[model samples]
Target: MSQPSLAPYVLKRPWLMRWAKPLSKWYFDAAAYRKLGLRSDDLIPEESEIMQRAMKRLTPKESYDRVFRMRRAFQCSLAHQLLPKEEWTKPEEDIRYLSPIIAELEAEVTERQGLEAMVINKPNTKR
Candidate 1:
């Protein structure tokens, strides 16, 4: 399971969210994946079963786009150059495409485990 995150906590408070917004933007910009034409979700490690399942759940077009971005990013990394600024992923375009699916899969796994562990009892019928 993914570790707990403070994102919800910060988001619930306007003051904390206001303070965090600029810092988060700066952090994402400094991370530089956007410069390589990749969305933040594109960087998620695919080594785990959850990620693999989430990837399989993606629409064909999204899957194709993801592969294209990864290849482009890989090429850019090898060439030691970023994509032209026009092609860089904009902040608005960096939506959480994969994360929701991953979360759904994790929830399903947890639900299945809970159901499997459930106990059943037989009613007494002696009269």
Candidate 2:
């Protein structure tokens, strides 16, 4: 789930972001998941514990949509075909839905670990 990324570096610089945006879009388009009516987040494997927790956190509608997209993509793969152009995922529609939840879960786990490691020392009572 934690893939190495240059996103933070690019995002920190407006000029670099401007140059990368179109190239990233072009790369995404060439990757062809949109042709199968799937968002980038939809392609994330659900086998990881973090992803499983994130899936549980999704709203009913989002859960349903995720499953629908996965099944549709599977069918497309089996048939060796892409969805119709009109049904393909658009750039704006490919927002990060699950990633935010996963990040939140990761943060919570880190916070929990920090709390678990805390030590409190009481001052001397014999004053």
Candidate 3:
């Protein structure tokens, strides 16, 4: 499951964004996933039904690349090493590929729940 975020609120106000941007950058650097050659989305567990379905929605190339990243990161972990700086996941390369799919799936689930919980009434008709 996705963690709750105040990012939307932070991003909408220029003053807040200015204050948060550097902090966010520092936090992300501290998290050190880039050095492990993994994007943020790559950390999402595939255990949940939504995540499983979201992963199924990935294009073949995206799926392959994700698996490759995971395998490489695993190897790095075993060796207790970071990727070479040139190969570290750059900021641009850390874009959300799976997040949009997960959002869409969550929307669909919400919509389905809303529809299921709806009540309808019909007027009687004369013959």
Off by over 4 Å in 1: none
Candidate 2, position 75, lDDT: 100
Residue pair clashes in candidate 1: none
lDDT of 1 by residue, 13-90 (tens): 999999999999899889999999999889889999999999999999999999999999999999999999999999
Model 3 segments more than 4 A misplaced: none
- Model 3, TM vs. native: 0.89
Estimate TM-scores for all models. Answer: 0.91, 0.88, 0.89
Best by lDDT: 1
C-alpha lDDT score of every prediction, in listed order: 0.94, 0.94, 0.94
Q: Write down the lDDT that model 2 would get.
A: 0.94
Steric clash pairs (candidate 2): none
Give a tens-digit lDDT track for model 3, residues 1-76: 5679998888789999999989999999999999999999999888899999999999999999999999999999
| Runs of candidate 2 exceeding 4 Å displacement | 12-15
lDDT (C-alpha) at residue 23 in model 3: 93
Report the alpha-carbon TM-score of model 2 versus the true structure: 0.88
